[model samples]
Target: MHKTLSSKQLIINEALRLGFSDIGFSTVEHLAENEIHLKEWLDNGFHAGMSYMENHFEKRINPALLVEGSTTVVSVLLNYKPKLEQSDPEAPKLARYAYGKDYHFVIKDKLQLLFDYIKSDIYPDLEGRMFTDSAPVLDRAWAVNSGLGWIGKNTNLIHKKLGSFVLIGELIINMEIEPDTPIKEACGGCTRCIDACPTKALIGPYQLDSNKCISYLTIEHREEIPEEFKGKFENWAFGCDICQEACPWNWKARPTSENEFQPHPDLLQMTNDQWHNLDEDRFTELFRKSAVKRTKYKGLKRNLDFLKKK
Candidate 1:
């Protein structure tokens, strides 16, 4: 710590220059608000088979416990809005986030760059770690505290101006920074995200049934695709974007400026039938570096088979 807050603004400025669309800083505190919701969801088994969510209870709250003497959490949002969308209405779909390189690698590089820049320019002595969705860090809670955005009914960060198409990453540092004012809930009285859920996964405002969430089914759940959810996935083959598509904030959505976020040539030209018959070879060439690789070939084929099933 430099015994001042100037170093805090220094980190945020560097994050913006590095192409992060939004950045916010907050003092590390226990996840007081999110704890009850999480515990209840877990108790109800809403996590489905994501047993790991139940593994890190205390760590998911107090940042200081995870990182020795951690004082501040810095949250950054990189927009992942794709430059192109699936063209065919009948095409089996993929999430926009998976259109390019795996976000874990993509976001980690940017976060590490931020850390290195902080080490050289802001505080050479400061120690911290950066993680996107890859860590036990409470990224959404930190983002809300930092005022970057409000957690919408969909449980995703909803930016007032930037919308929900952003990718969140964090750097937890021992040094203090100028705290960002928390963003107010701009969701108003709108229930669009709740009402539009195909599986009725939205239990209420700001709540979701993760077991029924399409994204969870297609991405996180490793078991058989639930027969009940067969046609409810809409056209999404990998992950669902229906709530985002139904959001008003997305109306002014612009293409992300990050070139790494851009889609591959094979992905851009995919047709509905091509996706249906897609085999291992084409899968490797198109998605070798893509986030879709997280689900692996067999998982994707499972989803595809589920989609084509009568």
Candidate 2:
């Protein structure tokens, strides 16, 4: 005779079969501690031009506001680690996450499928919505609250077994489920991420200064790259993975299993001179399905010019 599985266990099992690396649940409670951290990060102007961060003060901390009668937040970590990175040592480097198709679309599709499959169950009033790196959700906080992993010194969710290369998604539903115990910080006294930053972006243990972060200037900022960061970007033309690269937890990260997340051949094989002379046509053809499209043609040119100047 088979034992009856709880709703939470059934959900977790299904999420795994669907290819998520980790699935943990959190009660829909106010995140007071997280709110304070957000306030401090914003007050210090660490969020930079992203004013939207200040708009959803209440909704971010309280899932009750986002969904009615929300009791459980099913947080899932889908690995987006690319199968290949820029091969040429001197080729302007792209962030690992951007090497493949845009994760917002990839992960959101998976989340919706999970939602539909769960809805297929006989529960009459199973209400839920899937969220993946969009909206006002504080993904890292929710992932931590869901006991998926601890927020590392670089402010990324770091799993003991999977590292920080995971993409977080959530399914907030009205069903009751047992929540997992929160993971403790495994970073200890190690400051390799802090020490390895070329721009000193990590201002403190877990705090970062976005204005100085290479990832921010390259991808988030709208105007010219700040003169102060001129020589500090170290040729990174997109998001920075320096912190994660320095974290010891990454040693346990197996290469991603998702085919859609593999790097485009043209992107992976670009020579240094090719990247230096990359034009609109090649950029579009190569990154047509990747997250690098977020930067647009102009943004990529802007980043490339900045790298050239450096």
Candidate 3:
């Protein structure tokens, strides 16, 4: 057994062993280019009610500011594509990513293991923080900078081999490492994602207006859904996957091996009537560890009511 390996190889092997689909490295630096796009998006009120997007503006653009002394950014991907979907087509739909346990818990655990490995096995003095959609990290931007994939027209990080059905995470460390180069954009004029957005949320290629996004409306928006957009949700009661489902690259996505990512048996068998009749106790029982809990019972019931309205 090779007891010692280069820092890069050690990190890659450890990440893969921890079930990460792929990993890439980049030097920690200011994301000046993405800053302009982010500022424009915020200025356009595209973030809607997610005020956190406006917080930590400087840290979001420059990772070094978020993690002092960090000189390398390790980006990782975890595939969550489901092998099975909700059985009842008429049941209010959920984004495939929400089929099972909350990803923040699952991915963060594995990231902690990786962090421990770096300290115990590779570098005893290492210090950093790992994030998986829980912080102000520019995940997609860093993933692109790490050369794992290109930002698709839909603004998803599309890996050539893994498609867009994956979650991205990051580990920023103080150790400098060789960085990867960005991949070329491959959307090639495809407008399927934009054309498929029922609410016209994908205002244009690479641009999204969260105020009109189903995922944002059902999961993040606290107020009553706008009446103008009634009947356009396409039956989605939780997060939506219309954009990823419409993308060509997603056709190549494979089922995830992580058991935690598989749908609960109850989730698969739920009928429209069952969802309509769901009570708080049942909601808590089923979604105790699921990302679907993000919307909570009241929010979910709101979505159901909107979908079933006459």
On TM-score, the candidate that comes out on top is: 3
How much lDDT does candidate 3 score? Answer: 0.92
Clashes of 3: 0
Worst 10 residues of 1 by lDDT: 1-10
Ranking by lDDT: 3, 1, 2
* Candidate 2 lDDT tens digits, 208-303: 988888888888899998787777877789998999999999966888898878888777889989987888898889999988998898998898
Q: Tell me the TM-score of each prediction against the true structure.
A: 0.96, 0.96, 0.97
Model 3 agreement with the true structure over 153-234: per-residue lDDT tens digits: 7888999988999999999989777888988988997999999999999999899999999999999999999998898999
Candidate 1 residue spans exceeding 4 A from truth: 1-5
Q: How does residue 115 of candidate 3 score in lDDT?
A: 93
Error of 2 at 216 (Å): 1.0
Local lDDT at 100 for model 2: 87
- Candidate 3: where are CA atoms >4 Å away? 1-5
**Residue pairs with backbone atoms closer than 3 Å in model 1 (clashes):** 147-183
